[model samples]
Target: MIRLVIIGSGNVAQHLIQAFQKSLVQVVARHPETLHSLPISCPVVTSMNEIADAEVYVLAVSDHAIAALGHEIPGTGKLVVHTSGATGMHVLPKHHRSGVLYPLQTFTKGKPLDYSTIPFCLEADKKEDYLLLEQLARTVSSAIFSIDEQQRLALHLAAVFVCNFTNHLYQLGADLCAEHGVSFEVLKPLILETAAKVQTLTPTQAQTGPALRGDTATLERHQSMLTQPYPKEIYQLLTQSIIDHVQKL
Candidate 1:
């Protein structure tokens, strides 16, 4: 049985704690409150000093907290890894074997996720440690990737554009709907269909809108109808970008 110690108290840490609980892995966390929402059966402590020695210590803390936490954890040659996508492995303490076990999926506290669909991006300085990470990742997920720091950084950037930015657009759409006294629920089906279409169709192939068709009159009307300056500017910018992109194709 691989004994695992996870540090920090956030969405990623909590989600990881929950996932490992169902596996044969022994999980221990430095911060217990993070697991408050989770019905975890393992040990959870309040301090790093109270943490038990384990085969792997996963630093699931924030990007800024990583280097500081790495300094605090006693390595003793045990495998210590972080669950960061942007931060590189060099930020980890060199006294011990350092690695990365970044789960390439958005995590929400108290929200259940299908672990099998989430990819685990693994990286380690040593070959043995890499294999160990692979074994640990396999416990909860089948989608595993051996992505290095450079590749992970690129992937992280792409995720920001696809996930975070797109979600922001959804929020904007919701707000627009609310302003027009239309229930956001009305857009749910369209949103689902748009997302489902990407499963088999390329984003470019699935594209449909006034901008894609180069309907200048509709685009101008949309820009003019936007009561707010920011939204109107955004609409013009995005519409022009789409038109420019389509022209290249």
Candidate 2:
């Protein structure tokens, strides 16, 4: 088993600790209080100076802090990786064997997830380090892919569109429903069906809306109903995008 030292005590860190409990040797966090809920068996340290000897050091902190944290780690021989999608592996200290082990899924604290289904995007400075990262990733996930920095950035951008943007749209829908004295629960089934359809069918093939169909009357009616400026602008922009996509198809 690859002995691991995970840094940070946030959502990603906590999830990783649970997933790799067998291999975890130590957890390093700036605030010891943040790690109170962590496993008692695993040694927890407040600083990098006290970090245990391990084959891999996983920095599960925010993107802005990755480089600074990487610099604090004592050794250059061990593999040091971050769990960021937007940030590149180049951000880590030059002395260390740097890499990225970004999980392609949104993490919420206390929310349970099946790690097996989460795709792990791996990148490393060396081939040996890449293999080591892959081996470590397989302990939690079966879906692993060796993606370079550029590819990972592109994937992350697409993820923002598909996941983050889609969720914001759902919030907008819920707000509209609440305004009309309707329960957002009524849209749950539709949301589930739409998500399920994309599993087997292309998004363009599964697309069904006034924008896709070029139903001018319905589109105009919907546009007029949106009293808020921001939501109205978003609606128009997305509707036009859909229409343009269909025209190209």
Candidate 3:
């Protein structure tokens, strides 16, 4: 069994704790309320002093907290890893063997994740340690990758563009729909279809609409319909981007 201790109680931490609850896993949180927030039934404690011996220590705290909170872990030569996409693995305390085990997925509080489908990006200081981390990752996920710190940083940036930025655009779409007295639900099908198309076709290949066709009349019509400055700016920017992209193609 892969014995491990998870530090932190945020969305990522709670999800990890839940995913490995059936395995040999323990949890340590700095705040008792954070631990209580989850319906976890593991060996949970709120003090670093109460941390038990484990083969691995997974830090699932925020990016800024990883470096500072890492000091709290006892550096007993145990393998340590953080669950961050953007932070470097070197941020962990030097006393312990450190690595990165970033799950390249957006996490939501109190939501269950499909562990089998989630991709786990792992990195370790030693080749043998990499295998160990892989073994633990395999228990929860099938899609495991050996990603170095630099490559992981690049992937994190891409994730922000595709996930975070795209989600913000989704919010903008909903707001626009609301302004027109249309239910956001009416756009759900188009949104899902757009997402589904990318699975089978490259985004460039799946591209359509007035922007792709360089229909200036339709583009102007869209811009004129948007009375809000932000939406108007975004529409013009994206429409121009699409046209520019197609021109390159």
TM-score of 3: 0.94
**Candidate 3 or 2, higher lDDT:** 2
Please list the C-alpha lDDT of all candidates, in the order they appear: 0.84, 0.91, 0.86
Clashing pairs in 3: none
User: 186-248, model 2: which lDDT tens digit per residue?
Assistant: 999998998999999999899999999899999999999999999999999999999999999
Badly placed stretches (over 4 Å) of model 2 are: none
Per-residue C-alpha lDDT of model 3 across residues 68-108, encoded as one tens digit per residue: 87788875678889999888878888888888999999888
CA lDDT for candidate 3: 0.86
Q: What is the lDDT of residue 61 in candidate 1?
A: 90
Worst 10 residues of 2 by lDDT: 32-41
TM-score of each: 0.93, 0.96, 0.94
lDDT of 1 at 175: 85
Model 3 misplaced stretches (Cα beyond 4 Å): 37-39
lDDT of 1 by residue, 34-55 (tens): 5677777766677666667788
Pairwise TM-score winner, candidates 1 and 2:
2
